[model samples]
Structures are given as C-alpha cells and as structure tokens.
Target: MLHIWGRISSINVKKVVWTAQELGLNFQRTDAGGLFGIVKTPEYVRLNPNSTVPVIEDDDFVLWESNVIVRYLCAKHSAGQMYPTDLRARFDAERWMDWQQTTLNPASRPGFWQLIRTPAEQRNAAVIAESNAAVESLMATLDRHLAQRTYMAGEHFSMADIPLACEVHRWFGLPQPRQSRPNLERWYAGIRARQASKGVLDLALS
Candidate 1:
C-alpha cells in the first residue's frame, strides 16, 4: 500500500490526499504535522529533508513537495488525461501550478495564519488586510483567466485543478470579507463538488 505522512489540516497534505483519492489509490495517511508533530523525527527527515508535512512513500519511491506529488501521481496513473499529454497543455498545467505555489498561496497564507491560527488578540490586522488585498487582485486575474474555460488546463479536469482548488479553498475559508468573482467562485464550486474533495475541502482551517 502507498503511505502518506501529514496532518489533514495542512493544505499541502490535503492536496496529496485529494489527489490520491482522485486517482483511486489504496493508501494510508498518518497525522504528522502541526499538533501531531512527527515531521521532525530523523525517520521522516530521511524521507523529506525539508521536514515538510506532506510526503509520500510508494513501493520504494519517496516524494515530497505537494504540487510535485500531485503531478507525479496523475502522470503515473492517468497519463494523457489528468496529466495532459500535449506539450503545450502539460506546460500550461505546470505554469498554473507554479503560479499557485509561487504567487497565490504566499499571498493568502498571511491572512490564513492571522485569522485562523492566531488568537484574535495576537493577530495582526495589517497583515490580514494586505494578504486579503493581494489575494483579491490575484483572484481577479484568475477570474479573468477562468472566464473562458471550465478548468485550469482547459475543458477537462486535470491535475492542474487540484492544488489551485486547494488554494481557493484556503483563501475562501478565511473569515475575511471578499467580493465574489463569479468565474473564480464557479471554478472552486465545481472542484469542491468532486467526490475527491469530500473530506479535503470540507475540512476547516486550523
């Protein structure tokens, strides 16, 4: 059986869990980060030197980095479909995945940390405001990009949707106010409706 290490509350872990469920793989996940605290152990460090919450071990293969795991799983099990076989299409998926990690996630994380993880008295209002503002701008970009397509990579639901959708789930879960971007909301609603997202998206942020 494939083995995964990460607590469900971690967004990165949720991406892997959802991807695994979408692929219909038989797997086991252990709570290993946040309050769970197994990530620093030497055993886990040997699996992911970065000490990240989400790591996967499958039949002697060890992988870390949440987005990469999503790509690897889809490429392995659902090639030419979830993974995208065309050169342009595959890289288009890659581009958005990179943007989610490099741009959107970073912008929204401060809001999530301040609003969800930190106690109200300790939270920084400025940080939350800046984070929300950045996300709103980025979301407008996404909303425009998604206006013509049903999914990130095109009409089909591909691995590209997984991490980005996870990102939207996190951003939207924040208690901060946001104006509805119809296209963005539509895209997120579609992914949330997936059976693969049942436990993942429904989870509350910590």
Candidate 2:
C-alpha cells in the first residue's frame, strides 16, 4: 500500500490522490498540513525538507513534490499508456505538467488564496483582481492550446492532465468573473467527468 501524508484540501495533495485513484492504486492518506499540524515533526521533516503537503511513501521509498510524485506513479505503474511512452509525447506531457506548476498555479493562487482561504475583511482586493486577470489570460492560453487537441498532452489522457486539471479546478471554483473560454471549458468538462475526478474535482476549494 502507498502511504500519503497530506490534507485533501491542499491542491497538491488532490493531485496525488486523484492520480492514485486514476491508476487504481490502493492508498491511505494521512492529514498532515495546515490545520492538521503534523508536518513540522521530525518524522515528516525527514520525508520532505520543504515541509509541504503531499509526500508519498511507497514501501521504503519516499518521494515529495506533487508533480514529481504524479510522474513517478504514472511511469512506475502505467508506462506505455498514462505515462506516455513516445519520446515526443512524453516530453510534451512533461511540458504541460511544468506549465501547470510554474506558470498557471502561480498566476491563479493569489486569487484562490484571497477569496477561498482568507477572511473577507482581511482580503486584499487588489491582489485578487491582479490574480484573476492573470489567470483569465492563462485560461485563454489553455483555450487556444486545446482548440486543436483534446487533452493537454495529446489525444489520450496522460500524466499531464492531472496537475493541470487540479489547477483548473482551483481557478474555476474561485468566485469571480471570467471570460467565456469554450475550448478550455470543453477540455475541463471532460476532466471533471472522469470517474477518478469524483472526490478531488467535486470538493469545494479550501
């Protein structure tokens, strides 16, 4: 069994949990961050120096970082399929996964933090507005990118979609005005409809 340490409310954790479910891996998740408060302990510190949610232990092997964990699991369990065997397709998948963490998540997180996690009285409208604008622009990017392709990597669903879908779930759940992005919406609808998306995608952002 795979042992995961993280709260489901964390987007990073959601990515891991959804990937495990999608791969049909048996996993037990332990709450360990934010309000849960176990991460600072010596044991968790040994597992992840960054003290982040979503550190996974498979038997004796320990891994951290949500995207890396997703990649590891996919490659280890479903090599030629969900992991993408073709070199071009594999790197393409890697690119989109990197985009989710490096580009999209940064742009959207401020607004998500402001609206969902922060108290209204203490919220900074300016930051939220800026984040919303940046994220809307990224949504348009995804829309155009998906105008031709069905999924992030290619025709078949792959590891690339997991992180990006979690990012989309966070952004779309934010209460704000956004331009109609038909292509992006179409892509995300497919993601949300996946059986593996049930718990992660349906949850309210925290």
Candidate 3:
C-alpha cells in the first residue's frame, strides 16, 4: 500500500491525491502540515526537509515534491496515458508542469494570500492589484495556448493539467475582477467534469 502524508486542504497535496485517483491507486493519506503541525516533528523532517504537506512512502521509497510524486505515479502506473510515451509529448507535459511552479504559481500567490488567506483588515490592496494583474497576464498566456488544444499538453488530459488546474481553482475561487478568457474557461470546465477530479479539483478553495 502507498502511504501519503499531507493535509487535504493543501493545493500540492490535492495534486497528488488527484493523480492517485486518476490512476486508481489505493493510497492511505495521513493529515499533516498547517494546523496538524506534524510536519515540524523529527520524523516528518526526515521525510521532507522542506517541512511540506506532501510526503509519500511507497514501500521503502520515500518521495516528496508534489509534482514529482504525480509524475512518478503516472510513470509507474499510467505510462503512455497520463505520463505520455512520446518524447515530444512527454516534454510538453513536463513543460506545463514546470510553468505552473515557476511562473503561474508565483504570479498568483500574492493575490491568493491577500484575498483568501488574509483578514480584510490586513489585506494589502496594492499587492492584490499587482498580483492580480500578473496572474491575469499569465492566465492570458494559457488562454491563448488552450485555444487550440483540449488539455495543456495536447489533445488528451495528462499530468500537465493537474498542478495548473489546482492553481486555477485557487485563482478562480477568489473574489476578483476576471477578464473573459473563453478557452481557459472551457478547459477548466472540462477538467471539472472529470470523475477523477471530484474530491480534488471540485472542492471549495481553502
């Protein structure tokens, strides 16, 4: 059996959980991080030095980093399906996953924290505005790319969509002025319709 350590509310944890469900892998998830506070303990630190929510123990093989875990699961289970067998196709999926972490996530974090995590009294309007603009610009890039494809990598849903979809859920759930991006909207709708996305992507934003 696969043992996963994380709190469900974590976006990163949600990525692993969704991938597990998509692959139909039986996994046992233990709550950690945030209010749980187990991540600071010695045992948890040994599992993930970053003190993050998601740490998976697949037999004796321990893995951290949510995107890597998702990729590992897909490679070990789904292969040509979620992992993508072709060289160019695999890199395409990898590229989008990297973009979510390096580009989209940083652009969206301030807005998410200001609007969703912070109290109204402490929220910074300037930060919110700036972050929103940055995020919107990044989303516009995605909108253009999605205009010709059903999923991030290509025609079929792949591991590429998981992290970005999680990021999108956070941004979209926030109370903000959003410009019309027809293609992004359509792609998100399609993701929401997946049965595998149920407990992960379909949940209320934390």
Candidate 4:
C-alpha cells in the first residue's frame, strides 16, 4: 500500500490527495506538518530533506514535491488524460504547474498569511494590502485565460488544473470577493463541482 504524510489543509498535500482521488488510487494518509509536527522528526526528514508536508512512499519509491507527485499520478493513472500524450500538450500542463509555483504563490502568500494565518493584532496591514492588490492583478491574467477555455491547458481538464485550482480556491475563500474576475469564478465553480475537488480542495482554513 502507498503511504502519504501531510496535513490536509496544506495546499501541497491537497494536490496529491486530489490527484489520488482523480486516479482512484487507494492510499493511507498520516497527519504530518503544521500542527501535527511530524515533518521535523528524523524519520520524516529521511524521506524529504526539505521537511515538506507532502511525502509519498510507494513500494520502494519515495517522492516529494507536490507538483512532481501530481505529474507522477497522472503519468501512472490518467496517462492519456491528465498527463497528456502529446509533447506540446504535456508541456502546456507542466507550464501552468510551474506558473502556480512561481507566480501565484508569491503574489498570494502574503495576504493568505496576514488574513488567514496571522493573528488579528499581529497582521501587517501594509503587506496584506499590497498582496491583495498583487493577487487581483495576477487573477486577471487567469480570468482572461479561463475566459477562452474551460480549463487551464484547454477544453480537457488536466493535471495543470490541480495546482492552479488550489490557488484559485484560496483566492475565492479570501475575505473580499474578487468580482473583477468573473471568468475565474466560473472556472473555479466547475472544478469545485468535481467529487475529488470536494474531497481534497474544500478543506477549512486553519
């Protein structure tokens, strides 16, 4: 049996969880990272030196990094669908995954930390405001892309949707409604309708 270590609320963990559901792969998940505090243990560190929340052990194979997990799942299970058979199509999926890691994360983390993670009195108003503004602008780009297609890569929903979908959920769950990006809302609503989406990405904020 495959074993996974991560806290559900962590977006990276949610990516792997959602992928597993999409693949219909059965696995056991253990609570680690965040309040669970297992990542620092020598045992957990042996699997993932970075002490990341998501570490998967399958047979003798050990894999960490959320995006890599998503890719591996798609390749192993949804070969022609999520992973894509065409080289160009696969790169398209990979590109969006990288975009989420590079662009959306940096733009959204400050606001997420201040608004959701940090205590009210300890919040940085300036940083929160700036992050909010940055996310709004970044979301517009997503909105325009989504306006053209049902999913990030194209009409077919692929692994590309997984990482970006998690970020979009965070934006939607934020205090202020991002009314400026109606297309993004429409796209997110579609993903939220999926059973796997409900299972993995719909977790309550910590």
Q: How would you encode candidate 3's per-residue C-alpha lDDT over 24-115 as one tens digit per residue?
A: 98999999999999999999999999999799999999999999999999999989999999999999999999999999998898888888
Q: What total of clashing residue pairs does each candidate reach? A: 0, 0, 0, 0
> What's the TM-score of every candidate structure?
0.98, 0.98, 0.98, 0.97
Pitting candidate 1 against candidate 4, the one with the higher TM-score is 1
> How do the residues 1-206 of candidate 2 rate in per-residue lDDT, one tens digit apiece?
99999999999999999999999999999999999999999989999999889999999999999999999999999998899989999999999999998999998888888998899999999999899888888888899999989999888999999999899888888887778999889999999999998999999888
Off by over 4 Å in 1: none
Worst 10 residues of 4 by lDDT: 172-181
> Each candidate's root-mean-square deviation in Å?
0.7, 0.8, 0.8, 1.0
Q: Could you tell me which 10 consecutive residues in candidate 3 have the lowest summed lDDT?
A: 197-206
> Each candidate's lDDT (Cα)?
0.92, 0.93, 0.93, 0.89
Query: Runs in model 3 with CA error above 4 Å?
Result: none
